[model samples]
Target: MKKLLLVLAGLLLVGCQSGVELRHGYWVDLRHPAQGARPRIKVIVIHYTAEDFPTSLATLTDQQVSAHYLIPRQPPQRDGKGVIWQLVPEQDLAWHAGSSFWRGATRINDTSIGIELVNNGYRSTLTGREWQAFSPQQIASLSALVKEVAQRYGIRPENIVGHSDIAPQRKQDPGPRFPWQYLAQQGVGAWPDASRVQHFLAGQTPRARVPVEKIMDLLQRYGYPVTPEMTPGQQQTVIAAFQMHFRPADYRGLPDAETAAIAAALLEKYGAAE
Candidate 1:
């Protein structure tokens, strides 16, 4: 009897080890993974928390808003390297990128990983709004994290974008002070070719008028969500979002020749869909 009980226990243990039990009296063999499926992650969205690390941590972990990762303005060092926080697991969805659209994908939160940087955003001063710059150490850590994530998921350069780029009409978290060009240089995101931009410029001055309609088409082609029904002011917000990523020197939402040229250059290089 004792020998029979031991055998039964061993058989149950072997069955449990061999198959994953489902809640509804089903068992799945995970030894053979389905080849037809793909990684859910398609894009990487960067953001700036308008609060410090402690506040950002509390908000991301406890509040409705959350991100996969949180990068401090000044990261804590470990083994002579800066360390970042991972609030949410990569396999799970986070509540970031609220009501966002990118390329042809809507509800961007479903298919993208969010990385929030600890930044004060901007303070309204008597002169103007002063934007806080990200620290070098912070950017270094962020670049490493972004590169690893992009490579793991085989994400395209154009797919790595700022929060503002995904939701131009309502959001502007990673502002002008964010070093997009520098990050692009580190193979984490896209940057328009200067020569291509000049080709589109065609010797046109910066202030030269480019048809607003044409600019809108170029922006839409590059994956910015610009609808024909949007007001003129609303359209300018989209342009400003693009400028904030590619041309951080100024982002007044003007549809100048230079802005149009940059948009054209990006389309030529990246070849967006619709």
Candidate 2:
């Protein structure tokens, strides 16, 4: 009787462990009530895993780091359809934005929801290899998700940002390849008026002066953390990140006449909220 009881106990333990493992595989919910008053979810920051699907799944579920959702590269079904996996609940902070800031708000994970997509970023580039484009199905799913989250939390369209936007000095995931213009056309995020910016750039005089401090101030107003104490090199890099998102013509880190004009135009458009 004692031997039989021991065998049954071992079986039960194995079964429980298997169940936990299965739950950890994908779309596991990690919601826990926050210790303090609930802050508003005003931003929806997007990121790319910079890893394959299996690795992303493991990392997100390990309790060391997490995001609210993970969109798989390949469709979950054998029929080649894409799926979005819900990892952490929207109400919980998911260790996604580390030591980050936006528009004077620091430690963004407390006030934002993060969505991570599985992509290897630029580090996985191979010579002569074509980069993979975001699948149509994936984009459709992401659009729907963003609309739902934005409406649910009252998040502004401009608040949907890439991880690179918040941590320009330290990180660059969801690279230039990510479709910002498409999302803007769908009314999910902000996009500057390209024609007006171009027109302003064209009409600049050779002796015309640009207020560098004012441009930087506008960037700060638009939720970029630029300080007066930043070194020249740091300032250049931050400007480059800004251009990467908005201009995309060239991220040369130089605030030339054209760049300044574009920045000024953007300020005119979006700085009212600031």
The whole-model C-alpha lDDT of candidate 2 against the native structure comes to: 0.76
lDDT, candidate 2, 11-54, per-residue tens: 65776665522244443323444589544898899998888999
Give all candidates' CA lDDT scores: 0.91, 0.76
TM-score of each: 0.89, 0.76
| Candidate 2 segments exceeding 4 Å error | 1-39, 77-82, 124-132, 205-214
For model 2 the TM-score comes to 0.76
TM-score winner among the candidates? 1
Q: For model 1, how does the per-residue alpha-carbon lDDT over 214-243 read when each residue is reduced to its tens digit?
A: 989988988999897999999889999999
Clashes of 2: 0
- In Å, residue 149's CA in model 1 sits off its true spot by 0.5
Indicate which candidate wins on lDDT. Answer: 1
Off by over 4 Å in 1: 1-36
